[model samples]
Target: MTTHQLTEAQKKQWEEDGYLVIPSFFDKQETKEMLDEAKRLCDEFDVDGHPMTTFKTAADGEHVGDEYFLESGDKIRYFLEPTSLSPATPDTPSRLLVPPSQSINKIGHALAILNPVFRKHTLESDKIRSVAKSLGAQESPRVLQSMIICKQPRIGGVVPCHNDSTFLYTDPPSAIGAWVALEECTPENGCLSFLPGSHKLSRTATRFVRAPGGGTTFIDVPGVEPNEEKWDDMDGWREAPCSPGTLVLIHGSVMHRSPPNPSDKTRIIYTFHMIEGGKGVKYDEKNWLQPTEAMPFPVLF
Candidate 1:
């Protein structure tokens, strides 16, 4: 295993900016393998009978069901772009067939566990362990979820500025996302834009989850209110464009967003989040997405 150690400057940057961009974190050969695996999964998974869940934004977004979303938590399933389907009432189902050209938005929470190549890169790589150490994580980090996000050409959806902990909440909010670009990511093709030092300013306000009865809802975190001001000010936000194999580390509380793809090319990326697995840190039981019975998220040491 090749260990990629972070320099002191890189560590300081992470502390100040709430994010770090490591150029060419993976070599050409490794990135090619990942891209190949992603393509294979996309081709193999049948979207016909699969539930047509779409990529939802934080504001003015529709809530998804537990059965439709959570059932595929630890399995390979395709989610469609929101623009592909027409709106429908609760009584009437509006699921549509995603065309082969722009069928998928993302596939998630299971690739690292199920695919050997992804597993090696995520769990066994020394690079990821070095990142955990740089963050001053007391215990080994546990990988919570993994997915491949595809920003399809011209029709991809916009992801609103939000924090990672809002989706995967721990008691003290310990999540950190490791995103690797499988293709060149440019502003034209929906590259990630982040608010500098936003992690220090905001606490987790609400989390996405399934209500006790049925469908999904955003419940408030105790003693926290949504901070509109943090996201409102775009002056400090910076775009982090990256080349293929670059890894972008995102702090859990940092506010980040990606625009819709209006360009002709697609932006493909592989990503996952890790949380501190020490005894004191507790993973919230009420979070909407949970590990499946067949394949639970694995610990990365």
Candidate 2:
């Protein structure tokens, strides 16, 4: 079996292109464990007294933020599938079309520290930490965001093309996404597609930050306001298909998106972002997720 350390070829690919799809990064047992755990989380989640917020994305880059979203940084929170709900009236919220177990779009933000299973496979593994060091995380890499993106079956939730640094920002924009496939991901089932070398276009990205008055707003990135033109592709966009255990290391600035899962199979994935943390790196306060002293970002050792 190959070790988890980045090979010379993998390093060269990352250096030149800012993205890599490393096959079999995890073993079968490891992949199976995570998939089963994600299903268990979805099955055991209770809907009583919980907010039924649906995750929605716009073609134009505008994002909708609520208190439930803003406060989820330090906690494990569930977001409902936008397609799994009925239209809302004045008083009542959107009603769920499916049962609670199958209605979640994702569980996110703090799973690496809050959940033992994720923590073990994530922060606690020597192989994972070794990989982090190879990625230039310096002596310490602070992981603040971890997610189980459950591309729910058949509802057709599609994420528009966007980068990760827009949400998790640093001064020089240092965020690396560690995306592991828990099940087979195919183009037909909304697997990730990438515009390779897009990260080198601009280290500085347009951020989606918290607005002072209320809600969220886009700022800093030198460009026009939210519109379809921003999402227009120039060419060289390609789909990346993966089997179980494949790990795709994505540059925070690389433009990537997934189509709707028209097939019955769910394209579930486990992903987390690690940003450079130290004196030189500055994590902005205006970013969507803020780390309190009580729940500081977990460092990989």
TM-score of each: 0.92, 0.93
Worst 10 residues of 2 by lDDT: 223-232
Question: lDDT tens digits, residues 1-301, model 1?
Answer: 6788888899899989999999989999999999888877777766557666776664664655647667766776677777777677989876554665366788876778777988888887888777667667438677867889889888887888888998888888889999999999999999999998988988898887777887777888888877777485568889999999999999999989999899989899999898877788978668877875566667787
Model 1 TM-score?
A: 0.92
lDDT of all predictions: 0.82, 0.83
Off by over 4 Å in 2: 1-3, 137-139, 203-205, 221-231
lDDT of 2 by residue, 16-67 (tens): 7778998888889989999999999999889887778767677776565888
Query: After aligning candidate 2 to the native by TM-score, how far in Å is the CA of 2 from where it should be?
Result: 9.5
Q: What is the Cα-based lDDT of residue 297 in candidate 2?
A: 90
Alpha-carbon RMSD to native, per candidate: 2.2, 2.6
**Candidate 2 lDDT (Cα, whole model)?**
0.83
